[model samples]
Target: MAKQKIRKGDLVQVIAGKDKGLQGKVIQSLPRDGKVIVEGVNRVKKHTKVGQTARGSQTGGIITTEAPIQVSNVMLVVEHEGKKVVTRVGFRREEQERTLPDGSKKTVTRSVRFAKKTGEAI
Candidate 1:
């Protein structure tokens, strides 16, 4: 399996296509397909066939729901210079767990930086 930089729940914005400038949380990521489903983005209507035995005899209508957009068309939203900016993945040095003065260990987290601009971690 190929490793994917973007994961579910990551806030991303559409950088191209009809949904450009729209930002939403990632519902899922399909690395194999190079596509991602975002909340409230690239919404398309889905039609469902109604059956006679349906509850309340309600007729199904067009349902608007988000569809997956190509990963290349979206950019991850990150913070930069006190402002929100699109960012590409850049890894920092891995840090080990730190022990506090009170004898407690904390999970270490590395900083995330912009791929093109800053070299420093988050």
Candidate 2:
């Protein structure tokens, strides 16, 4: 599987659903599931149980929490053409460098180019 361009802390905007057009920072990302939980978005309430034996806790009430949204439902917010926009992957940069498995220099290169649209370090 390919790595994701969006990270846990990336700023993203919801592009679909009732939360469309809403923007927030990513709180968590599940690359395997291609879902991300944005802060203060997709809020859902969860029922809680109050136990008589509690440590300095008096009451238990409904807990509101953010739920994970599909990654496709959100777009990576990026600055392009002097405007903030959502973008896809572009060209990749070629660099002359390789990590050695045994702590030895195996290969060396010069420059690497990355996708300007997605800001991915390709």
Candidate 3:
């Protein structure tokens, strides 16, 4: 499996589906399923039977929440030139020097995500 680009708390815009053009923050990421739950998008109503909790408190009722949507349906939103815009994600590997416990500096390579539209780190 490839790495997941979209992450929790990332602002994204729905590019396809009934919620097209809607923007929201990603609440969760499901990399294995290639899905993400966005706040205020793909709202779903769930019905539940009345039940008692371990604390003896009421626990079930009609609930509304965001449902998972395919990661492809959304695009990451970034601010560009004082305007909000959607951009594709790109990964880049960079080398940096790190100091080891032995006081020796070592070069390490790390992957980073960046905005393809503006060529800027994200």
Tens digits of per-residue lDDT, candidate 3, 7-90, equal: 999999999999999999999999999999999999999999999989999887899988999999999999999999899999
Order candidates by lDDT, high to low. 3, 1, 2
Task: List clashing residue pairs in candidate 1.
Answer: 111-122
- lDDT comparing candidate 1 with the true structure: 0.80
Enumerate clash totals for all models, in the order shown: 1, 3, 0
Which sections of candidate 3 miss by over 4 Å?
Answer: none
Per-model TM-score versus the true fold: 0.71, 0.69, 0.90
- Using TM-score, give the best candidate's number: 3
Better of 1 and 3 by TM-score: 3
lDDT of 3 at 108: 99
State which candidate, 2 or 3, has the greater lDDT. Answer: 3
Residue 39, model 1: Cα distance from true site in angstroms = 1.3
- The deviation in Å at residue 4 for candidate 3 is 2.0
Better of 1 and 2 by lDDT: 1
lDDT of 2 by residue, 1-122 (tens): 76666778877889899899999999999999888999988999998787655466566679999999998898777666677776654445455656688877655545443446657553
Question: CA lDDT, every prediction?
Answer: 0.80, 0.77, 0.95
